[model samples]
Target chain A: MAEIARLAGVDTSTVSRALAGSPRVTKETRALIDKIVHETGYVVNETARHLRGGRANQILVIVSDIAAPFYSDVVQGIVETLAERGINVLLGVTLRQAKREAQLAKQLLTGVVDGIITVTGSIPKPVLSMPGFERKVLAISRAVPHEGVTCVTIDNCAATRQVMQHLHQRGHRRIVYIGGPNYSETYRDRRGAYADFMRENGLAELARMRATDSFNDDADSGFHIMKSILNEGDRPTAVFCATDELAIGAMAAARQADQIIPRDISFFGFDDLKLTPLMSPPLSTVSVPRFEMGRRGAEALFRQVYKDAPSSSKVVLDHRLILRDSVATIV
Target chain B: MAEIARLAGVDTSTVSRALAGSPRVTKETRALIDKIVHETGYVVNETARHLRGGRANQILVIVSDIAAPFYSDVVQGIVETLAERGINVLLGVTLRQAKREAQLAKQLLTGVVDGIITVTGSIPKPVLSMPGFERKVLAISRAVPHEGVTCVTIDNCAATRQVMQHLHQRGHRRIVYIGGPNYSETYRDRRGAYADFMRENGLAELARMRATDSFNDDADSGFHIMKSILNEGDRPTAVFCATDELAIGAMAAARQADQIIPRDISFFGFDDLKLTPLMSPPLSTVSVPRFEMGRRGAEALFRQVYKDAPSSSKVVLDHRLILRDSVATIV
Candidate 1:
């Protein structure tokens, strides 16, 4: 650091900041410092510099599956935010594979990133036990047992409870809950909330007909899940899905079976995506704070990456229930 | 390189392969080579290495928008293919913003990536004229007038004509065509096909009902566009949309207006997305070989990047039309 500073005729701090691509330094001076480093074959050891400066320019993001549409927006938000700060982001998708998750954790032993943000629940304790993870990891949309790992997510249980409450208020006693695979954090949150809300409201009889988690948010999957329920010949008056895609699928199946939405049966969905409103009977859904989640998640990572400041233990955002034409009063 | 080989008591080529993280190299040798490089402050100049090997390990991919769902599969294919060859991918999304597109072109000027693949239309000729024109470059889903630029796309014009023939065979005369914005190569192909098909078939009167370019594949956008046509007291017995999202929206609008599918009006869509089958009345549309297109596009870029082959001028893939419940014979 002192050698570069002496060669560039600047203070060691200015040299450090310039090399770090800090905007506070004049562009011309930064260029001069960069040129000197290039000419002299001088390369700053990023790991060592990070240790000395107590800050890092890297953020790690772990997602359950990169292919899933639900995570795309959230990942975009984090990437855009961190990119602005000149911080590099390392993304890992577990694909909901436990072995892959373990491998991803082992890979993180490279210690390339300063902090970690995970959207998956199954974070292995062995990875966090690494010496570098004292204060640099946060989880989003999932919970971690480690007190060191803070989380940013919506109140999934509360939101699903509200969905049940809304359905009840609309005079729907017989309501079906369409859930995804058991491994997902969202499935657990929503299912737990549904059971609690139903029991508390004395609607346990209505909760007896639960659709198994097989289908994703796609219509084909939703159709089959809805079909099995309808095939039982004990039709629910309304259906609540863990995700909007599932709701759409179920709606298609109902229509195919000649059951009308909001007329013969009502539907409620989660994560009100752009396509939700375009459905024939505009779907009613809980709008996950997608844009905000993106903004906050990224902002949180950047704060740690740049300022070396510890983040809030947990950051919870608000989710809104959007009432559309999919639900109706069962007079 | 010779120093590492001497230290490890191995051949220079063995040392080089180990340092490059080649799986062919023994794990012990690879680790030893990495340690030697770290200890000696050795930096591998990628450009110089590529110059000797006649191949580069980096690829640049430019797309119109990353937020859309269509490109995810394409990216996934490219990533998978590149990961196998130990090549790194630099993804750039233009977001339909011209400045960002130009900026991305500038980034390519530094020769950071060995080859380029673009889904965006005509890169300003000046941008392509940049210094590193000798490496590989392919355009996906677009045609550009560059000597070395290869184009990989579906035969859009033929595909459109096929759809029209299907509707015609179903005995539909009053058919309206929905197209995309004028800026894209895709719109040009489909629109040109529509014009020629109508003229040849003596359906010139019906061709005038082409929907405005602003109607992107959104449900509301399609709904409003369809509503305007219906409000004008001019209704097409059949509608052919350029994209499936638009067709879904148009169908939603027709339903909102109390029009029955096939019974009152029939619809056809392009791009047989997964949702098409799940639609209330499954959409009848043409299916683009999406996974194949993605695979071919990546393979083309990789071949050019590694072989320095004169970009094969163009590659066109096959497409098929799917018949579903959305269209019916004019009864």
Candidate 2:
């Protein structure tokens, strides 16, 4: 550190502040220090620095699947928001495995990361029980149901109710709900809301299908479920899917089965993915504030980690019902 | 460690091996040690362990964007492959910013990670010039052009030639090529191949369009570029895009202009994304083995970091041309 300071003609404290990305260090000084540090091949031992009680200034962002399009926008939001604050994000994809999630939780408790922002909707049980876990953990997209972990999520039930109301108003009585696994609180709420809306509207006899395999909820799963339903000749006027990927797959299956979209069956989906707008008839789905959820989640986590704020707050962002060409009125 | 071993009725080395996820540790003993560790709230300080000359067992995977969808499958492959070896993945998204890329490269040098696998194609100059960097760095998807960095990539030129030959065989004389930024060697190779093939086939007069804004190469960019071309009254018989996202967007623009796919204009794309098969016309694209690229990249990186092998080798994966409904047998 002193060598870098001498090379950059700055004090050792100034060199430290620059390396820490502190705002107190002017841009010119930071640049000089960075140049000197790079030129001198001075590798900062982050592990040693953290061992000496300095902040890691790094957070672990955990998600269920990295390939799932749903988490991408949210993660982009988190990475961008945290980057502006000079924090590095270390992403961990659990692939929906419980053991992997536990391993990651242990890593968090081991102090490699200063905090964790989990978009997987659930925190490991051991992590929740750890002392000070609340202060260093935040959840997004689904509520963790724990009292201490701050969550940034949308009202999935309300979003589902809006979809149901739209379909109901369009004179659709025979609507089939295809959902993902019920392990996710978000999926569970959506399914529950659909059931409630149907029962209250005197349309409770409609059949429902859910992804039996907990590990599969993507487009392929949606396609197979829709194909089987079509094969059984149980064609409803409309199909409501838990996700846009599922909806896309369902549409493909319907096409393969010689069913025309909107004319033969209307499709509604959740989590209005980017591909939704470019679909054949375009998908009528819920527009989730995924990026906002991530941004807000990171901000909330930062508050807890840096400001010593309470970690029990819940922030629900707004969602919109995007009615596109996929839904058609039926008399 | 001693306390845990005492509680689990095992030696300290057994506990250590179990914690390190060594193959020598029996599953039953590992489970017992894990249970005791969790029950006793024993936090394994990874930072301290690394400082004591132990392996970090973590690698950093860097990409340009997380939401682009192009990197998702590749990242999944890397994560799964590394996880099997008990190595954790720390993903860093640079968002295509050079400054951010430099920052991430600096992080790798700081000893927070054992090695780095960059999917972003180019490594920062400082990182490359650092002593012994060759033993700890790997590139994927695009060749780094640096001597010592092992690259796992596909023959973009060959893939483009296959697409071109397929189009030529289908009697499509007028084809347009739309590509991403030239900063990427992958895109550059694809573009170069298109030019060479067009000239070789005596079709040099065909027009070409590329995304001028280096940062924007997604669906929206494709849509705008295609829309502009349509507005200018340049209706090529076929359009080939560098990526599936771009092709999807181009198809949407054609649809908006009331152009029926394949019947009015044919469309072809590269990178057979999971969403490709679900598109309205089921886009015909080059199926680059993205997952295998990732898997191979991770394996090569492991060899360099663990086995102390040379890092100058290049692994070129195969690409397949998928025939789907989007392209027509035009006369």
Candidate 3:
């Protein structure tokens, strides 16, 4: 550090600030220091720094599927929130698999990181219930049975009911519920809400399709399931999916089968993901506060880690229905 | 561990395996073991483990943007590849800021992890040129000037030429190139190729739209730029964007302007990111081997880290032009 400082004609602290990417130093000064360090082959010895500082200055953020746009927004929120506090982000993706989720949780529980924010529904229940784990954990957009862990989620039932009522008002007589596995709490709550909405409105909930992977991360299952519905059974006037991923698949299948969107059958999705608006006929879906959920999850986790506050609590954010070109008036 | 095992009537190895989420034991056994550990108030003291083990057992993955589908697929590949070797991933987002990239590289260069895989075009040159860093770093889908850094990139010139040839053959004479920044090597290469293709084919290259951010991580720039082109005079018959994100924006702008696609204008994009098919008119794009690039970068990093291989190399993957509804023959 002193050598680079001497070469750049700056103080050691300026070099340190530059090395840490602190905006305190000008870019030109940093570049000069960087050039000196590059030429000198100087390294910071991060292992020694880790030894001196116990916290790792980093957090592990576990997401269900990195490829899914739905989770990426929340991950974005988490990354931005943590970066503000100078804490780095470690990413663990489970592909919505319980084993992978459990493995990630166990590593963190065993102490690789002091804190974790998990956004997967399939995490092993035992990992969540581990003693001392709650103080260092946050659940985002998913429910964990353990009492001490903080969580930020939306009311799935209420959101589903709103979607259902809107579809009913649009004169959709028959609606199919395309969802993931019964094991997923995320899907379970929404499915239950749909059933309740159907019974209350006197609408028959006869058609339901589960995407091939009980978890629905596979993007093509929605299309395949919808195709079968159109081919084998009485067609529902509308279909509501548990996620935008499945609905995208369903919409593609409809397009391939020459079933015009809304004109032939209306489609609805949860999670108004980034690409939903760009769909040929824009998709009408429920918009969950995904980024807010992530930001709040990080905020809650930081409170426990930095301020030593009580960790066990919950915050349910709001959801809105975004009606676009996908749905239509059916006579 | 012994006390928990004895209390649960299981061997200490069972407790160890369960806590590590080995999956050798049944979930029921794991749950029982977890209950015993929770009741016994046992914590695995991760600090001691990290200190004793001497390595963080994780790799840092620096991405251009976490929310973009293109980078996410590559990251997913890297995470999966590393997990197979029992290594974890630490994610750093540059947001296309050179300062942020420098700081991330400086941190990793100093030794937070034994290795880092960076997927960004805006990384500072000094960080890559820093001695001893290349032995522990891999660059994915971006060209770096440092000879020591191993990289996996597609042949941008060849891919762009194919796109230009296809559009020219489709009877489009005036084509607009919607690109990122002149400073960005990724776009510079493709732009150079487009200029070459235009000159060789006796076509004029007049329209060039740089996305709102020269760094191009923000996905909405293409739409904003395309809208301006629509409002102005002498519209090109076709537009080719550097990324699917930009093409998506361009398509939306065209739709809003009541400009029918293919008939009025043709659109082409690079990167066959998932969700391209679901577009109103499925996008025609150049499919870069994003996941493969990520996997190869990790492979290169691990080879150098674990096997003590050489530090520098390059691998150019194939690119495929996918023709879809976005473009059409114009007489």
TM-score of each: 0.82, 0.89, 0.84
- How do the residues A1-331 of candidate 2 rate in per-residue lDDT, one tens digit apiece? 7888888888988988888889998888888889888778887677778778757777888998878888888988998889778777777888888898887776677777789999887888768777788889899997786777888988999999999999999999889998888988888998999999999998888746566367688998899999988987767999999999999999999998888899999999999998898888899999998888889999889989988888866888999999999998998
In model 3, which regions exceed 4 Å deviation?
A1-54, A125-129, A205-212, B1-54, B124-130, B205-213, B217-219
lDDT of each: 0.73, 0.86, 0.80
**Any residue pairs clashing in model 1, and if so which?**
A217-A245, A217-A246, A219-A249
Across A81-168, the per-residue lDDT of candidate 3 in tens digits comes to 8877877788888877767877777666655666888887534554656657777888888887677678889999899989989988
Per model, kept true contacts as a fraction are 0.16, 0.77, 0.66
Clashing pairs in 3: A280-B280
Off by over 4 Å in 1: A1-67, A86-94, A98-117, A122-129, A134-138, A209-217, B1-58, B110-113, B122-127, B209-217, B307-310
How does the DockQ of candidate 2 come out? 0.64
Q: Tell me the docking grade of candidate 3.
A: acceptable
Higher-TM-score candidate of 2 and 3: 2
